[model samples]
Target: MRIGLDIGGTKIDAVAVAPTGQTVDRVRVPTGFGAEQVVANTLQVIDALRGRTGTTPTAVGIGIPGLIDHETGWVRHAVNLGLSEVALGPLVAEHVGLPVQVENDVNVAALGAAQAMHLDGAHAYLNIGTGLAAGIVVDRRLWRGARGNAGEVGHIPVLADGPPCVCGQRGCLETVASGSALAAAWPGHPGTTATEVFDSADAGDPAATAVRDRFVAGVASAVRILVVTVDVDSVVIGGGLAALGERLLLPLRADFDEAARSSPFVASLGLSSRVLLAPLDQPLAALGAAHLAPESAVTTA
Candidate 1:
């Protein structure tokens, strides 16, 4: 068995995956800063899950947000968690006494989504949740580009004079199209999540509807770039926002179709039905990490 920990801004998801591709048991705890406390929470979850599985985990994997250098076990910046230049993987390994690998959470989720598939072809995973990002899976391996910053698709600057991004860029895809933007425009709702905004738009709230339409354009534009760049067969959507289903998807599909309809470069791409909703609601990182543990690294004694 293997252990996977997905640390996010709001929650920490831990799971124990058996060898046969099953999530046998799961645990979750709210997330916080105080880096030491965050690591402690993960250890506690792992300790609690250790008993039932009957074997020491072959490996441990953690998924965190922000820019990470997986090779050096360094997290250059993780703003939501208030960490900068933290040696995250080594610290967690010290506490847990296991081989641990740390990676950008969205990338892990992408791997997990890909892992859930048949694995005979290339695919992409797009997560639009509290934020927007992607993970690329080609030929059954993650395309971690040079410097491990391959999938910073959210900051890819789709607009020239767009709104300001947390990354300090203007007109970035995440600024105008993500859950944060929808929540900013409509603040008083019961559920300020992305789903609620779409629900409000579905119910005819003008402000919500405006953001919804803009969001579709933005998402379709982003997906088009991904399709053209990566040439993947399909893109899977996961995370909190995806719970809204076709209420969000239909419009996105329409936009992608409209955008790709006339491009000769994208003509033979066959991307009309390329976008797909993830079968699993939880983000993919933790599971992908756990699944990767033993095989990704080998010991020499």
Candidate 2:
């Protein structure tokens, strides 16, 4: 068995997966603030899964939200988790006595989503959740850029005068498109979550509808940016807002279709067909993490 963990902004998801990709056991715990609590909470979840499985995992893989030095397994920064320069892989390896491989969460999720969809060649995983970002795969391999921040498209400037981003920039796409942005901009209610905004829009609230429309447009723009830039096979949408299902995809599809009808260049790209929603039930990031370490790293322990 192998242990896979996805350390997300809100929750840390861990799973024990058999060789056949079947889940042996899974556990989730709320993500803790600060580096120490995050590591402690992650270990607690791992131990719980190990107890349930009654065996030490052959290898362990972790997906964290930040710029990870893949060679050292040190996280340069994970803003949402309040972590910086934390040696997460070494810490987890010492605690579990297992070989550990840590990667950026979205990059691992890209692999997971590709595996789940049985995709090959090139694909882009567009995650519009707590923040907006993407993970790219080329020829079945992760295209981590020179700085291991290849897919940090969230900070891409979409508006000249957009809201501020934690990355010390204004007009970032995340400022307008992310779940955090949606919650902050909800017209009908204060502290309304992205999911709640979708709910209210579904109920025909005009104010909520306006926000939803703009959000969808922003999402469409993200899709266009990915396709025009990379021309990947498909752009798979995953993350917290993905739970809204067709409520999200349908509008996005309509927008793309309209764009295609207006511009032959858009139609020629067939961008709408390439945009897809990720499966709801799949724990892709964790599953991808399970396969991250090579076979040589698996220990008898």
Candidate 3:
């Protein structure tokens, strides 16, 4: 068996995958802050999976949010996790005595989405979370690009003087299209801000409708950029807002359809038809991490 863990800021979603790609066991634990605590919780989750499965895993994979050196499993500037720089892969491997692979969270999610959706050719996994970004997958393999910035689409400035982004940019796609953007536009929601905005819009609130429409337009722009630049076979939307399901997807598609009406270029691309949502039922990040295990260690049925 191979173990995979999706270590998020709030929780760690872990799984044990058999060679045939079946999940043997899964576990979840609250993530700890700081490097030490994060590493400790990761080990604890691995132990829990092993105890439940009653078998030792040959290799382990971790999908985490950060700037990662995938070759060495080194993590840098994982602000949410309170990690500055750490040899996460080595530390975990030393304790568990297994070869470990660490990769960016979105990248792993892309891999999982490809496998789950049975997608072939090229595709992009667009994550619309607190920030916006994408993961590129071609023929089931990740394309990190030369500097590992292949899918950093969120930072691409759209409006010349819109809002200041955390990346020190003005009017980035993320500034207008992400969870943080929704929170800024529709604050004071105890629950999900995106849900609240959509609900208020559905009730015909002009302010809320404006916010929703702008956010949807920004998302549609992101999809257009991905398709036009990479020409991916499809763009799968995932992340916290995706929980809104068809409520979110229908508007995005509608935006594309509206644009298609004006521009033959947009119509030719079939932008509306090429967009999709990631499977809500699966822990895509953890599943994708499993695929990062050494090929020789993976067993197929």
Candidate 4:
């Protein structure tokens, strides 16, 4: 068995995967802030999973947000977790006595999403959560570019003069399309802003409709960018807002269809047909983390 952990801003989801790619056991624990606390919590989850499964895992894999040196398993600029620069992999491995590998959260999610969706060939997992970004997977393996920024599509400037982004840029696709963007456009319901925006738009609220339309347009633009850039086999939409399901998918597809009618190039790409929703039922990040473990370390029956 191999252990995989998805360390998020809120919690750490841990799982043990059998050699056959089945999850044998799973556990969740609150995530901690800062390097020390985060490391401690991660170890705690590993211990918890071991106790639950009553078996020693061969290797450990971690998926976390922020910039990471995949080769070194070093994490940097993880502001949300209060980690500036930490050798997360080496520390975890020293403590647990198991080989460990770390990767960007979105990359791991792309790996997991591909496995869950049974996608072969090139695909992109477009994460539309608090921000917008994508993870590219080609032939079931992550394609992290030379600098590990292959899928930072969110920072692409779409509007010449638009709202500023946290990345110190103006008119970024993220500023117009992400969960944060939806919350900023339709505030007051901190927890349910996306739902509120879509629901109100459905009721014909002009203001809400405008927000929804702009958000959908930004998303459609992202889809187009991914399809044209990598020409991936498909783009799977996932993240918190994806819970909106067809409410989000329908409009996004309509936008694509409408654009296709005007642009033959767009029609030939079949952007609408290539778009898909990630499976909501599985823990993609954790599963993908498991897959990150070296094949040699996976134990067979």
TM-score of each: 0.87, 0.87, 0.95, 0.95
Q: What digit string (tens of lDDT, one per residue) describes model 2 on residues 105-145?
A: 98889988887888898898999887899999876567877
Q: Pairing residues by index, what is the TM-score of model 1?
A: 0.87
- Winner by TM-score between candidate 3 and candidate 2: 3
Question: What does candidate 4's lDDT look like per residue over 1-301, in tens digits?
Answer: 9888999999999889998888999999989899999999999999989888998988998999988888777898688999978988888888788888898899999999988899999999999999999999999888888888988999999889889998999999999999999999988878699999998999999999999999999999999999998999899999888898999899999999999999999899998889999989899999999888474221221
C-alpha lDDT of residue 207 in model 2 = 86
Candidate 4: segments with Cα more than 4 A from true spot: 293-301
Candidate 2: give the clashing pairs.
Answer: none
- The 0-to-1 C-alpha lDDT of every candidate, in the order given, reads 0.75, 0.84, 0.90, 0.90
* Candidate 4, pairs of clashing residues: none
Task: Compare candidates 2 and 4 on lDDT and give the better one.
Answer: 4
Q: Residue 116 deviation, candidate 4, in Å?
A: 1.1
- Model 1 residue runs over 4 Å out of place are 187-193, 205-207, 260-267, 293-301
Q: Please give, for residues 52-106, the per-residue lDDT of candidate 1 as tens digits.
A: 6667877788888888777656788888887788877777677667777777887
| Candidate 3 wrong stretches, greater than 4 Å | 293-301
- 10 residues in a row with least lDDT, candidate 2: 292-301
